[model samples]
Target: MANRWLRPEVYPLFAAVGAAIGICGFQLVRNICINPEVRVSKEGRAAGVLENYAEGEKYAEHGLRKYLRNKTPEIMPSINSFFADPNRS
Candidate 1:
């Protein structure tokens, strides 16, 4: 009976082959099904479906205002100090 499993160099070869197969499989799936699908919404309210730059800016400003209005008291000191820094260039 031959004991082929005793070879120490076979482990690296097996690992390399497994890594190659995994990478090739990942690339194949990414090329076929992982692509981004861009669909424009008729109602203009779906997530990640902004229609124009103006709408995006409006959303951003609204979000910032909401955050500032609801921010925690502990964070207020840091925020105030950042704006009050006269030496800021």
Candidate 2:
């Protein structure tokens, strides 16, 4: 009866879910360890007054944000470029 669950149709669903969960887990771990805003130790905490909140935010940017920082913010760049004439100044 358990063999009924082994059908080929469910493999992609399984892989997709696994990949999503794995990516989430990896980002979670990465944030917990590397993100400067997330301090795990007592010693890691700031003791004195600091004014550079943006500095911590600078280092705290997630993977996706870092990747998209330089790239144009668009849903479909190719399509937009095709519709937008380059001659218009």
TM-score, one value per model: 0.34, 0.58
For candidate 1, write residues 1-89 as lDDT tens digits: 24586477788998998999999998677545433333334443356644566745553566558777876666578777789888865
Global local distance difference test of model 2: 0.79
* 1-89 per-residue lDDT for model 2 (tens digits): 76787789889998999999999999899789766566777776754444677867776675678898999989998788878978655
| Deviation (Å) of 32 in candidate 2 | 1.1
Q: Rate the local accuracy (lDDT) of all candidates.
A: 0.63, 0.79
Clash counts for all predictions:
0, 0
lDDT of 2 at 79: 81
Best candidate, lDDT: 2
Return the clash pairs for model 1, or none: none
Residue 2 shift from truth in candidate 2, angstroms: 3.1
